[model samples]
Target: MNLSEHYNALFKKSSELILSGNYTIDSKINDESDRRFGITLLVRPNEEIKANIQAFLKELKKTEPHQYYYPNSDIHITIMSLISCYQGFSLDKFSMSEYVDIIEKSLVDVNEIQIDFQGVTLSPSAIMLQGFPTDNSLNVLRDKLRENFKSSSLPQSIDSRYIITAAHSTIMRFQKKLENPEKLIEVIEKFRNHNFGKFTAEKIELVFNDWYQREKNTVNMCDLYLR
Candidate 1:
């Protein structure tokens, strides 16, 4: 199918899944000592963009009051997962310093990526703001980082579905089964074509995950700036 057809199909399938309550939460299997780290494009939206998205989120909360929203501080677009201590790993073998060095070297010649938040889309577990880069700069950076990881001793993501093939910022997640799924779907459809805002992604961060918490938020370990 063509691009439009492909997205339409994906949206429809995702919508159905959201309404059916058949999606899984973003999580991994790990012991108490394990930590998860993701290599991602840290999107620090400007004040204007932040205000616009916050307003939209406030509106969403009016209808879906029970849903879980991501904090403004945690917004980012993942490029790929680097390591998971769950599957036999230690900081000594794959240090955060090493990850930063790899990302910095790989992105030495890369430039900042301009991304436009054009619309909202639904996936099984989260509501995402779909992003389109103004150019292929983000893709080029991702490719370069992937190449760096290929030659490193860092272990691949334990979760097979955690690959970053698309650029999206997850805005909200379902905390419980919605009592009125159709109504929620209607509200989301209204914003399917809404323009959220735009921002430049300047750095890739090595983020550490605290999975023991209820929200499972990530902590910024280090940043690699693009030239």
Candidate 2:
């Protein structure tokens, strides 16, 4: 299937799971005391897109009041997970300058990625902003990162969990049993075609972050600006 078809299937699957009561609940991913750190590169949607998302979220909050909603500060499009999270991970053990150099070099000639944020999609445990990149610039950037990182001396667990091929961003994750899945599904269906506008990403952040990418738990290591 094509990229659009693949994500459409994902949305349909999640919707079916919700209606049939077969979805997974949240895991201990939000555990405050558990320490797991990973490095991730991501892009943030501009203010116009954020405003559109906030408007939709205002409506969704009334439907699922107890679930975790991502704050405006944390909304981002992940470019790559340079390293997957693991317990007791620390930046002190690695060469931060090396990572910065490699990232800056990898970004060379990578054009700005234009994205259209529209609709909602979900996995069994979370709701996401369905992002569609207009071209293959996103893929090129990702491949360059992997290629450069692999050629370097640094150890990385990039895509060990899975390779990222889509452009969606998680907006909400279930932390408790869905009190009323039908009502939540109603909200999903209502704004499933939301147009959050389009913007070209001018920068990407490389961060050392917690599993959740919560702003309080994240530290920005460097930023790579695009053309």
lDDT winner among the candidates? Answer: 2
The residue-by-residue lDDT of candidate 2 on 135-172, one tens digit each, is: 88888888988999999889898889998988998888
lDDT at residue 201 of model 2 (Cα atoms): 89
Judging by TM-score against the true structure, name the best candidate. Answer: 2
Writing each residue's lDDT as its tens digit, candidate 1 over 1-227 gives: 13234445667998898678776554342344445433333545566766777777887887788777767666666665565434433445546666777778777767887878877777777787777777777678777777887877766552355545566777777766666777777877888878888888666666655432223545566766664
Return the TM-score for candidate 2, rounded to 2 decimals: 0.95
Give candidate 2 regions above 4 Å deviation.
none
